[model samples]
Target: MLSLTRRIREEILVIDRQTGEQIVIAPTAYRGNQVKIGIEASDRFKILRRELQGRERGPGPG
Candidate 1:
């Protein structure tokens, strides 16, 4: 895993070696304990928040 420290308006680029896909992640704003980020990627990519993953898909198999 790669970790980076970025300030507001700063960006990081992520590339996929297999498909040559690129993704850009930038911090737009920071308020108190919350931060807003912007992402640029192709439609082939799906972005999701960890907490919302299960909820969005509904109850999982029991």
Candidate 2:
């Protein structure tokens, strides 16, 4: 696992070396103790929050 610290609007990109696919994540908003993030990725990705992974269905294998 990797950890990153980014300011709002600063993006961190994740790339799949094999497929050359890319996902961009950035912090969009910040409150006192919470932050909102935005993600930009191809439709091939089934993006989900960690908390929702258990409830997600029909997710194809990677």
The segments of candidate 1 whose C-alpha lies over 4 angstroms from its true place after superposition are: 56-62
Q: Rate the local accuracy (lDDT) of all candidates.
A: 0.89, 0.92
Q: Kindly state the number of residue pairs that clash in model 1.
A: 0
Task: Output the TM-score of candidate 2.
Answer: 0.79
- What is the model-wide C-alpha lDDT for candidate 1? 0.89
Which candidate achieves the best TM-score against the true structure?
Answer: 2
- Measured by lDDT, the strongest candidate is 2
Q: Which stretches of candidate 2 lie over 4 Å from their true place?
A: 56-62
Residue 41 lDDT, candidate 1, scale 0-100: 97
Over the stretch 1-62, how does candidate 1's per-residue lDDT look in tens digits?
88788998899989999998999999999999998999999999888887877665668799
